[model samples]
Target: MSSDLFYALTGASLFTLGLYALIKHAHILRKILAINVMGSGVFLLLVALAAGGQQAFDPVPHAMVITGIVVAISATALALALMLRLREASGLAVLPDTSPEELSEQLPEAPSDVASKNNGKNA
Candidate 1:
């Protein structure tokens, strides 16, 4: 019935949805998006709690939310960079455990001359 309760419930619901999505999805990009959604939900809850029946707005939670936003952005950028690098190196977005032989099989074949040169030497 109250505004505070409404905002809190909304935030909790968003957090639950995001958490479920994060757990159910296997893709790295989806996981990142779910994490961002969860962060937004936490931010909403923080703001709602800070505004609880108060005439004057509190700045502490506001500052924390801002800091959280900056951290989320930085984390997202780092995760995206790592994802790109992984894709380039493995030609796949998702990582899976595979033996060295399996990995080598996925890679492009070496030049015949290079293969021959290495054939006479011990690994």
Candidate 2:
């Protein structure tokens, strides 16, 4: 196969794999990683297509890739920050809570010593 065709196939494979991972995983970090992978695949496809065109090399795709990189970095940073906040507030990373039992399972209980002390005073 031609070099361009090979690269295009590889890029398409990466994109498909990344999309699968993104959909299959529930964790925020995994989703973020999948997004990055998909972005890389898109960048690779753009570069490969740009290279396949006649003439030396187009600078437009390269510039677009650079801009995409910046946007991805910022988006990743924001996602991480939101994850941190969610963890701090709820003591868990995943969302929806699913069940009351699950939420109860994650919570910290009050100290037994303090409970006993209060009980003794009441008695």
Candidate 3:
């Protein structure tokens, strides 16, 4: 109907889709993307709400949105770092180790003979 209504609807849909992605995806990277999508939806909703029922633009919500965006970036960075560490340690990206057999299967192979020779030369 109205531009404001459309904005609100879009924002809501984006947020819902993000939530669904977060729930359905098993990859850590995908979860991060979903979080960013949800943050964008919130920013859109805030901007839309600020524009409504006011003649002059509101700086307060705008400032808050900027701050929120920064915080979201920080959070996403931390999440990525943690995910990387988990992947490095467990060889799995998202979910925790459930079966011992699967964990053993995911272990990295031993270095090749050429690599071993190189290491011996360096030593």
Candidate 4:
């Protein structure tokens, strides 16, 4: 088999695995990793397609892959930042809405005299 064929097969396999990872994993970090894997697979395919064997490798596809990699990293960084913010806001890193209403429940009723005294002080 030609080197191009081998590279193409490898790229396809990587892309397939990445797709599986994205679908099977529920964690945001895992999804991010899967997306990066998919991006690498695409970059590999671009390079393989651009390889002309004898004449010359195409510079256009190479430049495009480089730019795409930069964009992918930027997107991943933004996604991670959002994930961190979400974790901070909710106090959980998992995907489910597990926040309990009991955690935010109101305190038990205070004595009526204490309440009246507090109200009078505020007034």
Candidate 5:
């Protein structure tokens, strides 16, 4: 019934839920959101650990949480940029859960001229 315990449990639950979503979802945006959720859970847990039953807040944990938030923001931005690049290249938002061979099979075939040009031969 204590606030710290509640926060700790909630943090754990968030982390677990995020982990499940990260594994279960194939969309890049969903995965990114899941990762952000996981980060938030960790931050919450950190804060809970720093909180010492009504004692003044520990500056270290607060500092660490701030740094983590900044890093998470940058990482999320980078992930989103990468996802956009992937979308542009593949024209899909969801990742395919297939082997490399299956992926190769799914790709469109190149034109004869393009194939020949790529083979280091004069077109």
Candidate 6:
């Protein structure tokens, strides 16, 4: 097969794999990583397609890829920071596949909750 075809297929495969991982995983970090993988696949496909054209080399796709890389890095940093905050607040990284109420019940009681309960008993 041609190199362009090979690269395109690889890009498609990567996108599919990333989609599957994004659906199958429960961890927030894993979801973030899957998103990154999907972005990479799209970037690869764009570059491959641009290179495969039968005309003068185009710089648009390359510029887009570079811009996408910068955006991806920023997005990743934001996602990781959100995950860190979630971990600190809940001590959990994986998402719950249940109702919001049930998820809330699963988390540990806060200091405020304990203090309120003690005050109620003493008062």
Models 1 onward score TM values of 0.74, 0.76, 0.77, 0.73, 0.78, 0.78
Candidate 4 minimal-lDDT segment of 10 residues: 102-111
Give residue 2's lDDT in candidate 3 (0 to 100): 64
For lDDT, candidate 3 versus 6, the one ahead is: 6
For model 4, residues 8-122, the per-residue Cα lDDT tens digits are: 7788889999999888886788889999999898888878867836467678988999999999999999989988986655543445332334322322343344445555767
Q: For this target, which candidate reaches the highest lDDT against the unseen true structure?
A: 6
Q: Write the per-residue lDDT of candidate 2 for residues 30-119, one digit (tens) a residue.
A: 888999999989998998888884669899999999999999999999999999987655455655325635545554463244444555
Q: What is the C-alpha RMSD of each candidate to the true structure, in Å?
A: 6.0, 6.8, 5.9, 9.5, 4.8, 5.0
lDDT of each: 0.79, 0.79, 0.80, 0.75, 0.81, 0.83
Q: Write the per-residue lDDT of candidate 6 for residues 83-122, one digit (tens) a residue.
A: 9988766556777687645765665574346445556767
When summed lDDT is taken over every stretch of 10 residues in candidate 1, the lowest stretch is 110-119
Q: Is candidate 1 or candidate 4 better by TM-score?
A: 1
Q: Model 3, 1-123: lDDT tens per residue?
A: 668767977888899999999988878899899989999998989888788777899999999999999999999999999999876555557653346355445543532343445557678
Sort by TM-score, best first: what order?
6, 5, 3, 2, 1, 4
Candidate 2: list runs displaced more than 4 Å.
95-123
TM-score comparison, 1 vs 2, better candidate: 2
> What would the TM-score be for candidate 2 when compared with the true structure?
0.76
Instruction: Write out the backbone clash pairs for model 6.
Output: none
How far in Å is the alpha carbon of 22 misplaced in model 4? 0.7
